[model samples]
Target: MTATATEASPTDSYHGFLESLEEADEYAAIDTALGLIDAGVPAERVLLDLIAPAQVEVGERWARNEWSVAQEHAATHISERVVAAVAARAVPRPTRGRVVVACMDGEWHALPPRLVAEVLRLRGWQVTFLGASVPAAHLVSYLHRHDAHAVALACALPMRLPHAHRMIEACRRSDVPVVVGGRGFGHDGRWAHRLGVAWAPDAPAAADLVADERALRRVRPAELSQLADDEYASLAKRRGELIDGALADLRARAPGVREYTTAQLDSTVSDLGHIVDFLAAAVYVDDGSLFIDFVRWLIGILASRGVPASAVGLTLGYYVDELRDFPRAARFLGEASASAAAGTGPRAG
Candidate 1:
């Protein structure tokens, strides 16, 4: 009666499970998972095909504006509960070797790594999932006490590349090979390769790599040398000044903005700081496209929230003006804001 992913016949129930997730029925979601496991469905398939795909659908719904942020959070939270229920069924004391999985510091998207941990656990591997936002220092310290066959670190945001680089190097120093994945590392995981670490495109790939001892790569240095430049550091030091300057200038440029509520002001300030943080990461990695891509994505987010792209363009201009002495920073700002800087066209209010 064993139902491994390849042999699982409960596709009908899994769709019903997704419907429950969309409805935010936490009880039903848990029931769906428990019922599948009770029906002899393989635990691996439950994670690999069911919960994992549902989480992706949640994100897609949010991206397409079909689901509100609240709805996405509700669906994701339900998925987390479902994963725990499934993992609770994992056979106690797996004979396979130990593996440590963690999300990069400041990277809070932990579901993907959790899914991988459960899959590996079902496959008889001992998995210590460090959960979301693991500091590099804590991870290195953890490895000192724990002997892991491999350490997999997940980073969901490219903005966290700086932390990822440091964590990868720390793990390398411990002689424990690191497997890096998630959207943060780009489609081919080019950033992981550039930083001198093994790349896994998804949980399945990571599991396959973990199973293949030869695929566990040992990397040296694990560093992106361009980080030695002072531009990123200089920008970081001036981050507060940049935020204040942009907010002040924005107020002057758009006098009507003063009428915005306290919440709106806070949101505006937060978005401005993200611009700085993302720009610093781009500069640290020497990748202008990171800034450009983030800005394009952010423009959509702001437009969805009823904020004009031109408002973001104004903040970009402030960065360009404040960092006038820094040609690279100014150049990135201009390139990233090209579309926003132009009138929002017929799409904008």
Candidate 2:
């Protein structure tokens, strides 16, 4: 049996960490984080240098449009689970105070808030994580019930901003300091200032803002608006590059792998490729027609290959891999054409 390839150190760990993440080796990243902890890396260091970097890559893959919603979701869940596990065993410090972490209404992505909870929990703060999409009323009621020193809100899409603003106001009226993070928050940081809340770009930064009264006092929501916009644009651009590079890189890396590897690789690649497509649609669909027509053509060909209709859903699951073999995909279209001689599934109309 072949020995598994291994990276030399944690500094070099991120590249392989990203590959393992790409390959969807969830536990591998977890185990690496644990190893870093065991190696006497501080919990904050583990989070800031190791786990945070990993999450950044995962987020970038999503932003670059390299991963589909499902791929991004899977990676997010894995990273969260891994971080939670590591955090569970984390050495706790004295309580800074209790804080509630939640996703604002209409905001389904929770990884940002979860990360904030973990970061604070590790810092010895009493953290209550309410997960994603909590209703505005419930969040406000919970804040009243717990009287938390602070509340942190996460929203990934700009569409969620209106809901986030409502939640922020609800918390503020109750005299609770609200901290808003995630992609959408930065888009309108100035608006957050008007609401009298704090805005953080990511969890680690949130931790600082939450624990230091002076730091929290120093934060101006108006200043935050530009910060959020800057952070959002930066993350969006970086994520796009990472994903674009990853799609090209992973596709180029696939044919050399084994069949079992190929199947999995193909699936992941397709998912990432689809993610890119989805983001492109999200970002630019209003501007002009995109690749829906091309995708329809490809989907029709794959449908004819004895690859079941249900498997078509898996196409989005493996977007990067599918795009890698444009020639092969075309050849398969020819095979699919010949195979059309035999009755199969529905063809593209």
Candidate 3:
């Protein structure tokens, strides 16, 4: 950690450490974290209060293209290391029952779960920190073997909501209660409730929720009985075609997009998958706003990287044309396309 003034404010320390993250200065990041602990900050507080905020900024910087993917990954990797280092020195209190912490399938963001796992340990709960993207089946098998009191599943992206539903159901089949968290569940946990699971808005809440006897009661099975139609499923089945067609269209019309480096091209593919995935999830949850809010955020990301806002319109129009029969998708895509065409998509904060 970089040296700071004797009376530096929290804001100053936050921004200063964030710069160290952007610079990929592992020593500075680690040292700063250690120094905070030495200055009487609790290890869990350092992880949640300070380190977590810096990590969030890393993602925001990447989303805005203010930082490259490599920088984002490097910084995230260091943040994870810092969590482990802090946990290594912390003392666990009297033991509570065992719990399992894992990410939903297809969710590669493991840092959030890792933080929660460590926090649970510090709170005196024995935890199995099953890294990232654990299959639903694997989770059930573990429940059968270890007899965990509860499962804490983390999902960091809205696109993973569908999979979160799957994991939630699998846990129910094995009769294990699941407490779901992460931004994917929405700030108010609207999706988590719809998916029929306990929702934790943050790590501390998750720990508190885990300690609640009522939360561990097996909830009802997930019911997306909200949507009267199957538009989301239909689009998801044709997702491959959507991506292929979009790539071909980009190759034909978008200058430089077709000639992207391997990394750039892969990122484009991932971004497209995220778009399709989120739209499907939004529809699955029967919320048109999810897709629109996402579009606004995506536009800001693309704009920061010099991509034309109208590109969002082009891509969305393709979806509208393909799903012309799906009234729900068509309506949402149409509205979003208009927003893109008029260059009015919302910007990232």
Candidate 4:
């Protein structure tokens, strides 16, 4: 009476796989993926369909406050184990050139790029997956030492786009063509376009892009002339000062924050820094929507944790007044504040 992989819908397999992730049952998750492969499901499908979507849901669950950080970490660990297990079962010989895949500097979510690495391996490319948060200098040195045909980079957070750009430029300097992906580049990779690098929406596209040498190297010029304004640099230089000022403003405006526990205080500081970083990234790309979208997302994340949206509004107001001299940054802050007040910001998934 048991359903076979073919008999079971992809939806059923995904739900069962997600359940394994939820329970942190590494064995069950591995068995589920391996079972799909044994039942003639392509290994690529098992990776992109079963594992990829499940990992995304894990992130969404954490965002919605249904899962704690510990739970999410546990689930992610199990997923990584599952990926390793699946990869071990199907060792494909490389038939194509070497492609190096890595997370951008400061980008800690290695799983996404790992999946991409596995896919490239399956597609016959010898892929070296340099896991999370690789520094630019080290990555450049590695590329120089090894004969890398191309490099694929990942960034999961939009706030890291500026850093991602620097990393991409470093790879370019080493004469390695770069293909960038992940949510950090925006869902459609608009931010990657702004950085003037090649972009892929997912693993399959990346695999294809890396195979075509000419296409992989064909990148438009980076549209960062706005950096001439010096606002992003100025804001970045004052990041520490801005965070300290925001914390002081918060304590004065909301006395309850003054009594927060050490952990809460640490989280508050991180959030304050994220706001400034996202704002700076927006200015770097000259895109107001980047900052606006982050504001909406931050409001939702805070709300799920029982924090009020008005608190964010208050902080935005403070930033707007503080940065009035920086026309571009101040204008972006005003747009975010207005979006938050009008409740027009999209709901965070």
Which candidate number has the best TM-score? 4
Assess candidate 4 and give its lDDT: 0.90
The count of backbone overlaps in candidate 2 is 21
Off by over 4 Å in 2: 1-10, 62-66, 187-191, 214-349
Estimate the lDDT of model 3. 0.82
Q: Give per-model CA RMSD.
A: 3.5, 15.0, 3.4, 2.0
Off by over 4 Å in 3: 1-12, 218-223, 226-228, 253-264, 345-349
Q: In candidate 1, what are the lDDT values of residues 1-349, reduced to their tens digit?
A: 4445435444667788889988889999998888777777778877877888888888877866789889999999999998898888766679888999999998899999998888777777899999999989999999999999999899888888877888888988898878888988877776777777788887878888988877677444445576566887898899999999999998999997889899889988998899998898888777787778788778887776677788889899878878888767888988977867764322211
Candidate 4 Cα outliers beyond 4 Å, as residue runs? 1-9, 343-349
Candidate-wise lDDT, in order = 0.82, 0.60, 0.82, 0.90
Evaluate residue 195 in candidate 3 and report its C-alpha lDDT on the 0 to 100 scale: 82
CA lDDT of 301 in candidate 4? Answer: 83
Provide TM-scores for the models: 0.89, 0.57, 0.91, 0.97
lDDT of 2 by residue, 143-169 (tens): 888868888888765435445666777
Report clash pairs, candidate 3. Answer: 1-28, 1-31, 1-32
User: lDDT tens digits, residues 60-152, model 3?
Assistant: 878777888789999999998888788877867748888999999988999988989988998999888999989998889989999788999
Ranking by TM-score: 4, 3, 1, 2
